[model samples]
Target: MKKTILITGAGTGIGKDAAFALALRGHRVLATTQTEAQSDVLRIEATNRNVVLEIFKLDITLEADREAIAAYPIDVLLNNAGMGESGSLAEVDMQRVRQIFEVNLFATLALTQVALRGMIAREKGTVLFVSSIAGRVPMPFLMPYSMSKFALSAAGAGLRAEMDQLKKNIQIALIEPGAIHTGFNQAMTNSKYQWMNASSYFAHQAEAMKKKERATFKFLEARSTQGIVNQIVKAAEASRPKLRYVSPWIQGFGIRLARIFGV
Candidate 1:
């Protein structure tokens, strides 16, 4: 059935792809970007590709933008706007760590609560969180961001159960994508270099760490986002969606293995 869906961070990456995919499937998609420029670019891209969706600017971190979602009577809320930070806990800026939580968790959770108000009032709706496999497995140098996702994963699970107990037909799901070549992961690791230096404890192996980071994504990051977007679409439409929807089954399996081995 066609539904009104609202997606954050829809100008790029998996969010952008999923917006187009969902809209092409005949869903009413309100695809929001972080900036007006992004919205403009998305408009052009959508027109060029003949994708149907309403593009707008919405920074989830901002109250005004978040309020706009409530006006839409949305049937599905896709939380995809998030930031990433990387650095050793001891060396990484504490402020950066806090900021990571602000964007990746606090804002997301708050927005979920907002969306829930409408959903709960109607007693029907779906909330899909775009979390990461990093939430399940510990990746070095990416601890701060991972920490946020850990909380996010927990939030989604707990909220899902909470709504279930209320006997509401509300559905909640987490879309965990691992190492997709969205340039976001690259920026995540690279962000560390901006503040990291020889004085840092890991200074001795800084270059090596950088090389390993690049190699990690180069080898693991999927070249295309088709599979990732497919999972998003699946979660969006599933009547009784699973708790977690992970893309690139192999990567998901790797996460399971790491958890089993206590990695």
Candidate 2:
């Protein structure tokens, strides 16, 4: 069954790839980017790929940008838009953490609420939150981003249960993807260094931590984005979508093992 799916942050990374993949599957995909330049690039890319996509600018944090979703009769709301903040919990700036929450949680929830209104009126829809595996396991220096994702995981679980109780056919799924080579991870890790210095308390450990962080992504981050895109499409089309879709199976499996072993 073809459906109209609205996705945020579709200008690049996993969201961009997923938009094309879903469109190829014959779904009407509204791929929204954070900026007009990104939207233009997306339009050109879609044209080059010979895939049809409704490309537009949508900064998740802006009210006007979010209000645009109301114009679409969306069957699925794919919340793939998110930001990353990497720093030590003890010394990291709280303002950055707050900013992280604004985009990853508050704004995300607000938009989801909007989608829920329409879906509830019709009583059938799917909502997929693109969370991260770091949300489940604590990754050093990535607390700000992880904290938001953890909240997202909780939101997904709690929302799904509420809908189930209400007997609504609406579905909510959390895409907990492991590290993927989307450049986001590298930029996130490197960001801390841009502001860190001798004035910092963790100054001594910062360099070593940065090295470890890069090494981790080099070895663990998947070289391909397909793993995540596949899960997104599955969640979108599932009759009874699962609560969680953790990708790069090995990473997900490892995380599960760590949990069982109490790591």
Give per-residue CA lDDT, model 2, range 1-263, as digits (tens). 99999999999999999999999999999999999999998899899989999999989999888877887888999999999888889888888899999999999998998888888888889999999888887777889998899899999899999989988789989999999999999888887788889988889888788788888889988999998899999999998999899889999999899888886
Predicted structure 1: lDDT: 0.91
Candidate 1 regions exceeding 4 Å error are none
Count backbone overlaps in model 2.
0
What lDDT tens digits, residue by residue, belong to model 1 across residues 1-263?
99999999999998999998999999999999999999999999999999888999998889888877788788899999988899998878789998989899998888888888899999899999999999998778899999999889999999999989998789999999988999999899999889887698988898888898889889999999999899888888988899999988899999999999989
True lDDT of residue 79, candidate 1: 96
TM-score computed on alpha carbons, candidate 2: 0.97
Clashes of each: 0, 0
Pairs that collide in candidate 1 are none
Q: Rate the local accuracy (lDDT) of all candidates.
A: 0.91, 0.91
